[model samples]
Target: MAKRIDVADLNIYYGETLAVQDVSMSIEPRSVTALIGPSGCGKSTFLRSLNRMHELIPKARVEGKVMVDGQDLYAPDVDPVAVRSQIGMVFQRPNPFPTMSIYDNVAAGIKLNAKRMRTSELDEIVERSLRQANLWDEVKDRLDKPGTGLSGGQQQRLCIARAIAVRPDVLLMDEPCSALDPISTQKIEDLITELKADYTIVIVTHNMQQAARVSDTTAFFNLRGIGQPGQLVEIGDTATIFSAPANKATEDYISGRFG
Candidate 1:
């Protein structure tokens, strides 16, 4: 099931330096929310914090709350690994396990989490996940092939299959289509539209057109100057953010006037 996310007074820090400051937003369940900003604006940093992936960095930490279904994800005693299981992530590049077969790639997460599923059940899950990712029909006969043997787009969809195989409540994609060709990008966009019916999705994109095309809601992030922490400039329905943002900075950035 999809889950709603509430971020309150969230600040992200690397060592002693703050990267994102006081960002608070509510992400609706079963919807796609796109985060857009120029390079170095902390858009990806903020996305990583949602799943506690940010803390993987040395000396990194987050302040305030990231609540999913009313549970604070960062509260004491909450396990980061468990939090990640509920929220799956895809990266900027398609990174299939180079040595693993396509079938094994999709089954990896499920096997890691469930540890005791029968072979038949694992096969069923791999097929279901590949179908959900829209790649089953294309690769059904090649299940034993190396995942990296596919084209760039197919590899990305394979990664998506892997992500959804675990049945996560939310999916976080950080520039998921950035490395793909135009055709591949479109395929991923269409898949995102379909998946939002079952998973709350948060995507960070530098491509404004892609953001406008795939997202239901949009959040614009910006920084004051060099060394300044990134802040949430404005957020609203996608149409409003693209056409008539209330904040001048948002309008300016969206209009291509400045970053």
Candidate 2:
């Protein structure tokens, strides 16, 4: 089972304007929790806030608490780097460090951020990371090759290898399959199911069928105003949400009445 992420009354703001409002949901561990909604619904924004990435923006602020396991991520003394190390993220696009070799790309997090490990330890970590990402069989012989030499799907998998190299407790993916072809997308979706046995996964996707296919729980968010925050419309098991959503807005959104 995946660990649960408990969010309470979470609100996100950029400068003086709010982007997401009063969102509360528990993300189950060892399973995929997907965030789905129309564009600009703040799914990506909310995903970033979980690891405090929103703090990178000049005036961005996150109110309320996000608890991973049993600890609050935004506690005054909490280190954002520490939070990120525990909660790894993959963007909508594959972002492997193009200049680095596949082996180095997978180990970058450990090499730069992780302070103490012997060379032997790093070798083991890199190998195991690739295995966990399901790319080892294909990339083992090409470890020295540049990350950019791989196909787009392989590049995305390389990114996943990097994220898992650090052994994160949670992995957040923002439309990870959006840039890939159907075969590549299926590869990633299968990887999600496989990875969940060891890591909790949260995904943001516009494809409802994708959500139903890979997610155990789904959360819906919708735009509010020109500048107001996007709000959580509904959240439940994939079966319940698709078969019989309780909220009218959810019904409308799922039924294709409006985005």
Candidate 3:
């Protein structure tokens, strides 16, 4: 099931340097929220905090809370690995396990978590996930082929399939289409629209048009200057953020006046 996320006073840091500061937002379940900002503004850094992926960096940490379905993910007892299992992530590039077959790639997460499962059940999950990612029709006949063998777009969808195979409650996508062609980007956009019906999705995108097209809500981030921490400028309904943002900085950035 999809899960709601509430972040309060969230500050992400790498050792002594803060990257994103004082971000508080509630992400509705079964919806798409896009994070947009110029390069180095910390949109990706903030996204990484949702699933504790940020902490993978040396000396990285987060202050405040990230609540998923009312449970504090930062609690002492909460395991980051378990948190990641519940909140899956897709990266900027199409990184399918280059050495693994497409079917194995989709089944990887499930195998990592489940002690045992019937082959029939794993097969069913692989098929369902591929279909959900809209890649089944294109790759069904080649399930045993290397995932890297597919086109760039197909490989991305394969990554999406792998993410969903574990049935995560939330999906975090960090520039999932940044390297794709226009057609591939559109396909991923359409897939995001469909996926939100089943998973709470948060995407980071540099493309304003893609953000406008795929997201239900939008969060704009900005920095004061070089070496300054990124701050959330504004967040609201997508239409309002794009058409009538209340913050001048947001309006300026969206209007192409400045980043």
Clashing pairs in 3: none
Q: Write the per-residue lDDT of candidate 1 for residues 3-103, one digit (tens) a residue.
A: 99999999999999999999999999999999998889999999999999999999999999999999999999999999998999999999999999999
Tens-digit lDDT string for candidate 2 (65-158):
9998889999999999988988999999999998899999999999778569888989899999888888999999989999999988989999
CA lDDT of every candidate = 0.96, 0.91, 0.96
TM-score of each: 0.99, 0.96, 0.99
Segments of candidate 2 deviating more than 4 angstroms: none
As for candidate 2, its clashing pairs are: 1-29, 1-30, 2-29, 2-30, 3-29
Query: RMSD of model 3, in Å?
Result: 0.7
How high a TM-score does candidate 1 get?
Answer: 0.99
lDDT of 1: 0.96
Candidate 3 residue spans exceeding 4 A from truth: none
